[model samples]
Target: MTRTKLLAKIRQVFPGHDPEDVQRVLDEYAGPERLRVHLAILKLCDEDRRDSPRHYVDSACQDHRDVLAWAESPQQLRPDWFSLSVTERAKVAKADRQQYARWLAR
Candidate 1:
C-alpha cells in the first residue's frame, strides 16, 4: 500500500494521534522487534481504544530532522522531498529541523 493510504488508515485508527507522532512511530517501529506487537496494538486500539502519541517527532532523530531543517533553512529542498508524502515527513521535516537545530546547538 502507498504511504498516503497507510497514513490515512493510521489516522483513522487513532484520530487523536498527532500526525507527526504517527510518523515518528512509523519510522521507529518498522522493525522486527516491535513490529508485530505494535501493529497488533494499533489494530487492538482501533477495535478498543484508538489513542495516538502526542509528540511524534524524534528529538534525537538528527538525520530526519536535518533533512527537514535544511529544506526550509535556506529555503532549499530536495526534489525527493516533494515526491514523498506531503503531510508526514515534509511537515515534520520543517518542525523537526527547527526543533533539531536548537537541540543540536546545545
Candidate 2:
C-alpha cells in the first residue's frame, strides 16, 4: 500500500495514539515485509472474524515470540499469507524465512 494508505490504516488501527508515534512504531516493528504480512493477515481476519487491527497489534505487542512462532510455521498453512499477491508473498516469505533461519542459527 501507498504511504498515505498505510498511515491511514495505522491511524485507524491505533486510535488515540499520536500518528507520528504510530508511524515510528510501525517502522520499528513492522517494516516493509512484516507490514505486508500484517496487512494480509488483517485483511483475511477482516473477512473471517471482523476483528479490529488493534486486536492483532495488541497480541503481537503482548507476546512477540508467539507471533514469530506462528510465522515459523509452514506458509502453505496460512491462507492469509498466501492471499497476498505473488510478489508480495515472495518478499514477505523470503524476508521472514531469512529472519527465522537467523534465529535458528543463533
Candidate 3:
C-alpha cells in the first residue's frame, strides 16, 4: 500500500536485502510501480534458490539504468526494454523526463 508499509514487508521477506538498496528503489519509483517491483522481487525469492536477496534489488534497478540510458540517448533502443514489467516501463518513462530535466539544468 504505502511506501513505509512496503519497505517493512520487503525487509520482512528478505531480511538479508540491503536497506539502502530498498530505499533507492522506493525513492526512484512511484507508489504503484514500487509495489509491482516489490511483488516481483518477492516472487523471485520464491522461485530462486539463492540464499541472497541482493540481486533482487539489482533486477529492480536494471530497468532504471536501461531507461536512463535510453532517455540520455533515445536513438538507441535497449534490447531488453520489452522484457520489463508494465509498471517498470511506466515508472521509467516518468523518471526519464525528470532525469532529463536534471541533466538539462546541469
RMSD (Cα, Å) for all candidates, in order, is: 14.6, 11.2, 12.6
Instruction: Report the error of model 3 at residue 6, Å.
Output: 1.3
Question: For model 2, how does the per-residue alpha-carbon lDDT over 1-106 read when each residue is reduced to its tens digit?
Answer: 5666656655554556676765554444453356654543343333345434454455566665444445454463466875788997887778767854553333
- Compared with the true structure, all predictions reach lDDT values of 0.46, 0.53, 0.54
Write the residue-wise lDDT of candidate 3 on 52-98 in tens digits: 44565565566644333433434235577688888877776777566
lDDT by residue (1-106, candidate 1, tens digit) is 3556456656767777675677667566443323322333344344445364222223223233332333234232555655667675666567756753443332
Off by over 4 Å in 3: 25-32, 49-106
For candidate 3, the 10 contiguous residues with the lowest summed lDDT are 67-76
Q: For model 3, how many clashes? A: 0
In model 1, what are the clashing residue pairs, if there are any?
Answer: 21-56
User: What ranges in model 1 sit over 4 Å off?
Assistant: 32-41, 53-106
How many residue pairs of model 2 clash at the backbone? 0
Of candidate 1, the 10-residue stretch with the lowest lDDT total is 53-62
Superposition error at 4 for model 1 (Å): 1.0
